[model samples]
Target: MSTNTLYGIFDDEEVLLASVKEIRANNIEIEEVFSPFAIHGLDKALGLKETRMAIMAFIYGCLGLSLGALMIYNIMIVDWPQNIGGKPNFTFYHNMPAFVPILFECTVLFAAHLMSITYLIRCGLFPGGTSDSPDERTTDDKFLMVINVDGDSSPVKEMLTKTGATEINEKEA
Candidate 1:
């Protein structure tokens, strides 16, 4: 199905945020918003759902901890036992103290790396990916708001112009 979109480019993030709130209040469906930097409270203004990246990070950390514990147990207790510093490696429990540092480090490493990967994938920003931004200025200083125009776009365009949009454009998708 063909879709028409109205794009409002603002010079400042504050103006974009206020425009988003006003547009949503007018029941206009916003396709997306593009900004050079994170605008504080813009997510709430856009009514976006809370992110679950933290929960995923926690799960990845747990997996890393388990893997680290298993590796340590297999190396020290099952495969080739070591008796470093006169401490016995008969079981994981006996050699647990020595592995604590590795466990913590692995957990943090997995959480950070995996979360970064997940964020990239979620944002469709992998290697050799093309940008989907409608305006190049959005990558520098301008803020852009995209509104889907299901019906007439004059009211939406008028509202955007009234909301301090520096430039407004219409396109079909």
Candidate 2:
């Protein structure tokens, strides 16, 4: 990864996308793109497909909801019976509104707690973790494009220059 070269930097996403388009039009290899914030249509512009993260989240949420329902029902009805205020201990429908709070709370609790874990696992992100990031300055003020030179440095540089890059540099990787 250290051998990766930085072709240029742009202050705007439009400029970056245009440059990417031109490079791809000429069949050049783009190793990766670095951005501080997400740019609209950027993945599509780069010909990348959507991630399955949301699908995973939905599945995990459903699992949480099922687990919560099972636990609540089993505790309230099967595990132990506690009668209070002359209310039926086993029948939940008599106090629908009160039980609603428990059910709703369970749904939210399951969704939030499990979805976070799912997101972390799916994205490979962990708490207080550090890894390869583009640059501190790039995150705030610039977009960086990395490409493989493939031993044709002159033409590759010329091609990138044509895309209106503000700066260009050749990197080892």
Candidate 3:
């Protein structure tokens, strides 16, 4: 499918931020925004919901903790019971304190690694993925706001110009 899109490039981050708010306030649909760095409150201005990554990370952490606990229980209690240094390893509850460090490390490790992988996959930021940006200047000093236009694009263009866009371009995608 092909669509007409208008890209407004702003030189300043503040201008881009204000433009995003104004464009959203006017009820115009914005396809996406590209910038060198994240802008504060941009998600709020774009009316985006809270991300679910943290929740997924917590689930991964719990899974890791459970796995660590199970491994420790099996190795210390079920597989080959040990009584090192007069410390009883017959029950999980009795020896759980010694495994606390391992449990915490595993939880953090799983959460960090899995969440990073999930974020990369979700954002399509793999090693060999093509860039989705319309303009390469957005990777450095410029900010680009993309708007899908149907029928008429003059209104959107005028709005962007009024909002202090440094340059504006359109293309069929």
Per-model TM-score on C-alpha atoms: 0.95, 0.81, 0.95
Q: Residue 163 error for model 2, in Å?
A: 0.7
Candidate 1 lowest-lDDT run of ten? 82-91
Candidate 1's residue-wise lDDT over 1-173, tens digit each?
A: 55689889999887888889988998888989999999999998889998999999999999999998988888889999977888867878877887899999999999999999999999889789998999999999999999888767788899999999989999977
Residue pairs with colliding backbones in model 1 are none
| Best-fitting candidate, scored by lDDT | 3
Local distance difference test, each candidate = 0.90, 0.74, 0.91
Task: Sort the predicted structures by lDDT, highest score first.
Answer: 3, 1, 2
Report the candidate with higher lDDT, 2 versus 3.
Answer: 3
Could you tell me how far off, in angstroms, the CA of residue 29 lies in candidate 3 after the best superposition? 0.3
For 14-49, candidate 2 gives per-residue lDDT tens digits of: 888888888888887787888878988878778888
Root-mean-square deviation of Cα positions for candidate 2 versus the true structure, in angstroms: 3.0
